[model samples]
Target: MHLRRERSRKLIETFKASLTSFACEACGVDMEAIYGPLGAGYIEAHHRIPVAQLEPGQTTRLADLAAVCANCHRILHRNGLMSVEDLAAHLRARRGWPLAAEPRPEDWQGPDKG
Candidate 1:
């Protein structure tokens, strides 16, 4: 039973990764964009439906999942019951940022190119 659940989880994660953008869905933070090549392909997959609410043998839909960076994912789970959208909204409001702010080149400068 446990093995089956684990395998199903993996399958869902794989499917989400294939369909979703490599950037964090909530903040659009791509690993490579921030951490450079070493961070490429590094992201966390979040299940939209809390695992506790899922019943055995229930079907997990791709839409019910999200790809997020570590920081955003952590914030999503901080209160133990925060939705992705809620977290995103809270962050945006607090930071006074646009919902889908694009990263500016000047925003990600490497060490002084002097």
Candidate 2:
């Protein structure tokens, strides 16, 4: 159990460190842009596959994680682990925006760059 916790922690840290921008994957909320220096590189990781649902001996990779803001994270959990794509769609629909194709992470240059 201890080893599992340590591995999980390291994986999350590595995943966060891999990001070039800490913007929320679902809503594009850039914490640094919104809160300045204090929020630089700030983001919470969400499991694409809920941890509770993982099969025994299953492993998680960085690609299995999504960076999300606090509100979006809460909404995801509250809504039964709704997918990141689904949440983004819901937000777009709520704002009366068209559902355009989402850019891949590597192609996304963050809000300021675009």
The numbered model that scores best in lDDT is: 2
Tens digits of per-residue lDDT, candidate 1, 1-114, equal: 697679767876677558535777766667776677798888777888876688877866777778788888888888786888887777666655565334333444466622
**Across residues 1-114, which tens digit of lDDT does each residue of candidate 2 receive?**
788879999999999989987878777767666667898888999999987678999988899999998989999999878999999888767654443233333333456643
TM-score: model 2 vs. ground truth: 0.81
Cα-based TM-score, every candidate: 0.76, 0.81
The list of candidate 1 runs beyond 4 A from truth reads: 101-114
RMSD of 2: 5.6
Q: Which ten residues in a row have the lowest lDDT in candidate 2?
A: 99-108
The models' CA-based lDDT, in order, is 0.71, 0.79
lDDT of 1 at 31: 73
